[model samples]
Target: MGGNATVAVEATTNRPSSASIVQTLGGGSGIDTSALVQSLVDAQFESRNAALAKREETLTAQISAAATHKSNITGFSTALSTLSRSGNLATQPTSSNSGIVNVTRLSGAVLTDVNARVEVRQLAAAQTASTAPVTDKAAPVGQGTLTLTFGTASVADGAMSAFMPGAGASVDIIIDASNSSLQGIAAAINARNAGVTASILTDSAGSRLVIKGGSGEARAFTLEATETPGEEGLSALNIGIGASGTTIGSAAADAIVAIDGVAIKRDSNTIADLVPGVKLDLVSAQIGVPVNIGKTLPTNALLQAVSDFVDTYNEVFAALNKDLDPVTGSLKQDIAAKALKRQLQQLTLAPLASGAGGAPTTLSQIGVRTNRDGSITLDSTALSRALVNSPDAVEKMFAAPSGAATTGNGLAAALGAIAAEAANTTRGLGASEISYTKAKSDIATDKTDALAKADALRTRMTRQFASMDAKVAAYKSTQTFIENQVKAWNSQD
Candidate 1:
């Protein structure tokens, strides 16, 4: 029977539709919509946070770089200061001529009776023949044992030999068999700190060994066994009698010289140590029963100074360029860096090309040159030649007095000026530069503050998103209840 369907009971009016609930809660899709929104927001925040973190890292790197740059600048400044204040530069000897001059040349008279003199003598000794005996005819000839006696003390073992005082003259003998190897024997004798040399010599006459003491000392020789006899007995070998000791003598002159009225002693014959900037060499010494000294001017020192300056300048310039060049991705990327590079380049090349007064300025004049890399290279050789040819002219170029109309500056003075400018707080952006220091501080502060702000914002955003998630969850439950009631009513109908 087709009975009329019973009318279904409607759910309570208090129940709201899913759409209505969602609309009241600001129109979000039903599936954990708050969580999704929060996730997106959190992702955006993280992205920003990551960007800020990178920026802070970059800032930190920059600060470190700035500190390093400042240190380098300070080091350069200190080096420059030292160079400027280093009184007069030391002189170098000329290569072509003898590197000394006679004291009499300056006095216009023969300076005789020099106090320092070295004594030399020659030693003579008789030659002796020695031989080593082998047991088997087939056995190769080998070195035999040698016994040396000094006063009562005697040494027996392998032989350590060397020539006597005079070369191609007499031979000295040393007994060096102390339970040590040949090398050890040599080491022990050398360690004695006695000025002597030991060596072994072999010839068609067989092997001959010798020892020689230093000049002014006598060396003695004695031999116990000449050759390796099959018998171990010392008396069986019948080594020959040794010669009496003799003395070898040679002398090196004292290195003291008088310069500008100051008497100074040095290790080398060159007079650079006596005069702050003068290097003199001994040209000729005529033996007049009392030697007569000859004098020569120092010309190499000035040339070398200019050359050294140029080389040093170029090295510094290359370093500066590397630091400031943008293509290399160097840490330095500031106006000051650029300016320093420019200044170095200018300074390095200026001496080579610029002229003072009416004279033409050639690096050959001052002792520097422009290298292939557009940098300055010191032509020490050319400069030296110029100085030898015209020392006074070279000196004038570097240290000449100024005229009434124009004030002249020397190389030392110019370097000092550059150093002063570098040290000036307002000039280059070096360690003393206010702007550089301020930038360092300001960037550091900005990075710190930005990081702190980002951290705080992230924490607050986290809490807000959590609260929104709870509210969205409650709204979802209410919508589920309403939809379930509508389903039940339709089923009953």
Candidate 2:
């Protein structure tokens, strides 16, 4: 190992090997290279942020569209409800073919002491001379008289009474018990009240009396015999009349009420339809009908529509917020996502300021409110009240007015203008129109554009890595060449 004999010790340079160069440069082992890698990481985050921003924008547009659709449904529903409330909807008119007549007693009290008598007579002759005559002609001259006897005290004691055989309870006095017949009974009952319906029922048995009580309670019947002694004909007819002394009250019918100069006929007999959007229930029908008008909306349909609108709006907003919120850490990183979220919040809250002077400046006016975390809450009760109080105001706030320049910042109009250059369709855009076609076409086009941008950003990041890898390889090659030169120099020595 002496140095005199030309020791063959190989000299090697301290230059790094290829593997070391790659580890130091490509693997980001050094501070400078680590910083560059961090830059690429930051770029990746930016790409993600850009994607989320685009999604947020699209979702914002979608929420606007959904709000517009909801507004349209609400508008149509409100219009129909107005018609119903105003009683403008079709109804069957009152029938006029029949006549109604009221019947009331002139005496106002039941005739308890009246006498009723009926006689049966056959139109043909008797079968035999000895046999009793069933017909009036069979009875010999003046032998056809049939009479009912009422005692002398019958009328005074209120014991004598009479009634039409089939009549409900109406009866007339048979003044002459010896002479009054069934025909006289029928005539008296028929002439009592116009409300009663009277007719005769003639059959094989004989002619009988049939009477119907008028609209009022049944009339009382009593009979009193005329004291004519030795009247065999009156004694022969043993028709006994009794007293009926019961009374009942009659029910009064309903009357019609006119609404807004139009006869909106209802059996309830109420004046509720005079005021629009109110419902009244009939309370009683005595002298006149009384009613209680209900202030609440009759149906939950309108409230349900508002609820649906809120649900749909919240769904789209939630999706947007998930992508844009910084704390959630979605596919989109922070910068662009945060910007977009801030922009959306600003846009939504701008009109809510008191100075905005629009139809619905506050979220509560249109059924929305802010939660503790800046999220939105649906105020259904407030919304319902607002709609019930001023439905047209809400409708005009969301939709274009018929005759005037659109003063309100409606959802459809706002979204249409904002998404004009983007590939989203706004609500109320017709299918045949060029703007609408373009808007529809843009949905796919916008998505594609977003994807393309994301891909381009990814490609740029990869190219940058590739360039960094090439630089590391070149640095390793240089180190290898220098080491070889040092080896050659040492070998020559």
Candidate 3:
């Protein structure tokens, strides 16, 4: 119906249409004209579309390769930076008698060798005060304020101090009938945290309340008691030197040690300041024994760091060298690829800054040499001797002070710079890969446009075919009617 309307509209307007001329129908003309038109369209468009698809595939492969190359190079640069920093170096610590006193190195703490005689006279002790044995552990001792004061007190007088000078703020523990038992008083005293710990001690004799201070000279204390008129039993908890109600532990004393014949008194057994970069822990009283302490370069740590740097350097070069392979990589013919490989190779072989006092300048001089495959190999024996003889020179070679790029900044620094450049996202290979991806995207857009035009042409051809079919059907109907009329006229004659 719509096709008839289109033809009727054109006839009413007296305008000629593209399909105005009548053509024979498929059965009448003995031809499959619609199928022929579709075949022609396919022949016109398929080859160009296949070529565009191939171009997109090639571009995508190259972009992926570039991405992988950038990742490997960046990893190499990060590892190189670890080798350039001086803080990464390890310090070796040794003690002549580890059983006597154990030592450990602290982070960021520089240790140096020192010859010293350590004499441990005594270990620091805490002040402990104990109440006299009581028959009932749960019975209330008193109900009042138990005042604790800290100051220097003589152990002989039933009061004791820690190894350090007395230092404590006065604290008060309140005792009441509700919580005045040995266990209750201990809990109350502990809850105050007034520079002391409290516990109920049970022995064969009876139960007793004990309060102990820290193991330092600054922890001396005196305990006094005041009781309410009805709670005068609390006074039994009072503690002092020679006090009848309480017994004091051994006198608190400072740890005493002599290093190199210089006497030193510390508030605790863990002594760290007697010698520079050396800590002496007084385990037992050995008044005249000398313990030797030594510090050396941490050879194992140095070896591992150097090994990692070398291995990572080889990995970066391997990624670049693969481009030279004929069949595997897309970069085989790329000039940038060759230049990158050459840059890293030259940097690895370049000599580092000379040592402070005429040491080896090149990595090869210290037992790390280039292999036939362009990777480096290390000789541990040679490196160890070099380290022993000229340790300062070896360090300067890798971690020289900041100066001119060609003169002072070490080989590690130079290699790091090249790696950074190759992997730089803003202007390096990563950026180049991004451009490649964009180009690939443009090719995709072009293919899409070409395919869309082909589809549009198909739509136009279908509509034209439909109009021509309508005209052909109408002409066939007209010819059939005229032939029947001619036959009727002959019959009538």
Candidate 4:
């Protein structure tokens, strides 16, 4: 053996060189293969994932902004409708003496300023009759068929003088064993509804069978009783042309009222058709005295509505500006949101109605003025002056929502129409929100796909690096054995 011996292994047949293994494996150099594979996969899709995440954030913000814009306009329209239905825009009526007559304006009725002098001379009277008092109220009166006939009657000195039968079948009142008593007969007449009523009047003495007909001359009725063979008590209630004992009652007359010294006659005291929109609810007779019914203005309600309009209009205007901002807004690119600004301006500017030559015809004329910031301000003094000068014109300028559906007339109608259009799902604010939501969903799908690709890349790299790791361990073992053998050879030498 030689004095010093050394052996080196250069087994590079079908593999990488030793230098390449050291650089690739980093076995004793604290290099991790799993971490390296993950870094590679991240690098592959980092830029794409970042872009998708930013798009998702933007779409979510846009959806929120569109919803907010729709909510603001919808709230404004709802408030306007509420103000209209509160009757703040109508003219209230006032009665001088409510005890004599009470006056009220009907809903949706156009009422003029009427200070009419109304007088109720005499209330309408109905023809009434009463039978003689009897000893017992529940005792059987008779069993007969009492016939009633309607007619036009003539009165001479508060008594029936002549009668002409009207064209109709006579109404029959059946008096049988089932309804033979006074109380039973009254109930039978009520059930018939034959333009007359029957009742039993009982007092300290006895009970009397009283019958009354409706008011007016044409409502006067005649009774004809045909008694059975044994029941003759039914004949006591008979009153007509051929009555043996019963006498006819006084004539029924219509009510009499005077307006402008012109007497008016009607069947009822509650006169409505005489005046176009005025209803005179007569309570008592005032032969010559007249009560005045005048038109009154609701100043407080008008002022409150004006104040509320200003507040709500300002809120909607502010929301429009922010949502339609060209730069920082989330819904800046939405066409429906952008159109609201101009629509709001036009609605506030348009005239609700045409007034008198010198009267206010528009909201601005009554002092709902716009500011530089696209909001509105209320000038109460101008409105007060307009109301004082021409109350009718002021009322015509702001028409409220009316009818069963509460649809607006002028400004309310206009605002509601535009709000409804903007909120339409097919091509408006609703559509914008839908589009944004769909885009966000698409972004989620893209992010998932990108992550999947990255994971697959990581899996491929992990397998490839595992093979290299195993080879590095084998090469290190071979290198260690060669080195140990060389040292033993030197010792042997």
Candidate 5:
């Protein structure tokens, strides 16, 4: 190729093409322009960019660790709460004959270990009486004011005796020519809601108007009619004391139950007032057979609750004590985590208020021991003995002050407060999390800004290199022309 081989270059607005100029200048310019510019930019900013990247990664990891620690703390708090309930150690009522009678503990019921003879003589029934079968049940039984009075009534006498004044009220029902059927009468009676409900009893005997009063003796009502004079009166539908309508059902009867040989009569089968906290649900009439109702010892369940609490406590402790590493742990150097750890450890040793049973003063007295690894260990045998001997004391120690589900005053309460403080989103360790979150945001922003600066630097370097290459190419072109002219002159001489 000739010494000055002409090369056509593309047009440029900002600067000439650096690659084109570099090829034209070659070794004459004595500069590897691209490599030099990249080296300078890297020398100036790469370390700073790398440091920012590292810091961002660290902050992200810290945030993750903080979240995990917070979750563990919350779980521990919940476990503590479950451990401190009165129901955990409270006596549960069990009947020897559940098939005959189902027993349940009522709220706020403090059960004592006492045997009671419960004989359910009869189940309280609702007063239900049906009118004799009619040709069409839908036929109207006439509309009128069905005066309902509650008290003892007899189907034999055709009268409502022992009248209860306040319990008695009259309901006005409209039974027009459109509705004079037994079904219509039942609908009218049901629509009134006057201490009674009615329905059509359909059988081979045809449809009968069956009226059922509210349960118990007080719920018994006698239906007497005083219809609109022009309208058909409800006198023919009377089931009161065998006047004319056949009595298909009897009057409401009280439940008769004998407790400890004392006869108790209640309007409903569910007897709550008879026993202080005990409720007797009469399933069936077992007259002579006595079903014993009392509380059995609740030691095993309480022991299991304690064991679960210990397991949860250990989990929290282990996490807090874990070595601070990106892969394994996040809260090793965290102040809030360490503080919580100390507080929780101290709670196990702290003196707590004795519960109603008053067995042991401290948890250690119940055989929950602190291990050398900072985890808790439960001596099952000792715990069982303590529970068996003084369960109330153990319960009170772990129980909240009010002995209710809400939080206050106990080993569990103290631990719960500590956990809350550490995990609370507003003030405690939550502030630490917030700080880490802000740090992450700032680091991300800084990295973005740094990258933008790097990009700007690269653009500036590229523009400057292009300009330098163009200048060098122009010089090389002029030098080639001059040298060629001189060589031509020499050859001519």
Candidate 6:
């Protein structure tokens, strides 16, 4: 009979059996068992690993945005500090005759409307002592312990009078076989930073050792040589008046300067204590001629400072606003960035410095106007008027230090605070990076765990499926033998 249903009978029961189904389906289980196990293991871990990867990528993007936010804050701070350090915001001290006396302001001293007259009587000089001519610079000068003592020497009637030793430690220079020659001794003395310098100068007569001292009166020194046994010519370098060619080329003397005809003596040519807020460096002596010191017109300086500050302020706000934009992907609706943006906008109206009554304290008072779009503009005429009326106050305000970050309103201090917070390692700029890195690390660890589990599943399932397939293959062979036996028995019957 032609029929779709075809089966084999069992030997004992003589009924259609599972062996017939197996034979019809082909050999064994008729499935790629190895491929099936691999697909199952891949399915278990693929979705989890993909989720971890996506999270890591998002963290990376957030860290990049944090860097951008930090850049803006620090840029604002550095720009303000540069402006203050450049001295473009202050009224510097000016000298009428800069050739004679140059003026420099050392500190944030308010020298507004202050003037002074100074006259340089004589400039300070350094003392130089030359020894007698030597036939050979490399020849032995004898061994000794040369002691140098500093003192102030006096002269009366073109002759030596009295000597007063300075209250300083005496320096002893040792001369042995290694440093016994005039050149060697000079090298030995040069090694000491004891306010004394020595060198062998080859002159018309011969080579002579010359010793020079520091430029102050207290630095004048006299040499005493204590000779060792059999050492000759050691005392030749000693000072009495002293020796044949030993002479003081220039005596170290204190500088004499006059402030408004009042005499002042200092050990250096650069004088600062005579006048407040300014240091006067004497170039040459002018017997009675006076140099006038005064303040310069800082209108142009204020103009440029105002311009730079406005532009920088605008830039900082612009970048910060972008980061805090609600719809933007980067730092969207970030609380910290939003707060910083508001604080930066407030800096335009914040007081810059402390001064006398009626001074222009804030940037707005001095003509900086904020626009609707967060940018700012300067009014040159208003700034000039402030300069004309309150010149001292104007100088006082601009001359103030860049505000600190926390304590004061100086540009450096106030702006520095914001910058510090932005890049702060624990709680600010670096905090987000730390979080993202930690998350990425966790993702890596989870991926490792997931892979380990997947590997174990693949191994266990592959072994189990192989065992099941082998048992099923044996059972099918047994069923086929029984089915053939039943047919042969029926045919014999």
Model 6 over residues 1-493: C-alpha lDDT tens digits? Answer: 1121123222223333344332322234667777788889988888988898888787777777788778877877787767666676776788889888999876666665558888888887667877889889999989989888888876433223456788888899999999999998999889877888998889789998888887777767788889998986778787534344376677778888888888888888888787787888889888899989888766777767767777777776777677667786566745566656767777767776675677777767877888887777888788788878776655554554532334334656677777887787777766765776787788889889988999899878866775566556656766776677789779999
What tens-digit string does per-residue lDDT give for candidate 5 at 1-493? 2433333111122233444543433343567776777788888898998898887777777787677777888777776666456466556677778765667766545565557778888889888877777777665567666666667654344333344534445556666666667766777778777778888778887887778887786776766777767676478676555446656366677888888899878888787776665677889988798888877766777777788878888877776677343356666566776677677777666767544555577677788898877788889999888877876566556554354332325666666677678877675678778988998899888878877887798778767776666667666666666687789889999
- Cα lDDT of model 2 by residue, 1-493, tens digit: 2241122122222233444332445442133554565466567567656665676565455445433433433443354334323322111112111112111111111111222111111111101001112233223111222222211111223222323333333333342443245455345435554333334455665444343332211222222233344533422222233323211112212233332233333423232333332222323222222222222222254455445545554554455465544554342342323433343344345442122333455445666765655456677777777666655444433442223222244433333332231222332222112342355466557657656776676566555664566555556555666677688779999
TM-score, ranked from best to worst: 5, 6, 4, 3, 1, 2
- Pick by TM-score: 1 or 3, better one: 3
| Count of clashes, each model | 15, 11, 13, 0, 11, 12
- TM values, all candidates: 0.43, 0.25, 0.66, 0.69, 0.81, 0.79
Residue 3 of model 2, lDDT score: 48
Of the pair 2 and 4, which is ahead by TM-score? 4
Cα lDDT tens digits, model 3, 1-493, are 4475456545534424464232322533345666756677788888987888887886777787777777787666666556555455645456677766655544334454555666676778877888889989998787888888766556765654222234446788988878888889889888898878988889899998988887765566777788878767877777764457887875556777777777777878887776565556666776677666666676666677667777777777776777657687676765555657777667545667555566777677788877777777788887888888876556655562354475445655666666667666666677668777998989989988998988787667766665666566556655665576688779999
Cα misplacement distance, residue 194 of candidate 4 (Å): 8.3
The local lDDT score (0 to 100) that residue 134 gets in candidate 5 is 77
Q: TM-score for model 1?
A: 0.43
**Model with the higher lDDT, candidate 1 or 4:** 4
Model 5 — TM-score against the truth? 0.81
- Which stretches in model 2 have alpha-carbon errors above 4 Å? 1-301, 327-361, 400-409, 415-493
Write down the RMSD of all candidates, one decimal each. Answer: 13.6, 23.9, 7.2, 8.0, 4.9, 6.2
Writing each residue's lDDT as its tens digit, candidate 1 over 183-249 gives: 3433444555444444434555543223443221122333344543463333332222332221112
Better of 5 and 6 by TM-score: 5
For candidate 6, report its TM-score. 0.79
Off by over 4 Å in 4: 1-30, 37-50, 122-255, 267-270, 401-409, 447-458, 474-493
List candidate 5 stretches off by more than 4 Å. 1-32, 76-89, 99-101, 155-168, 174-194, 246-248, 323-329, 350-358, 396-419, 429-431
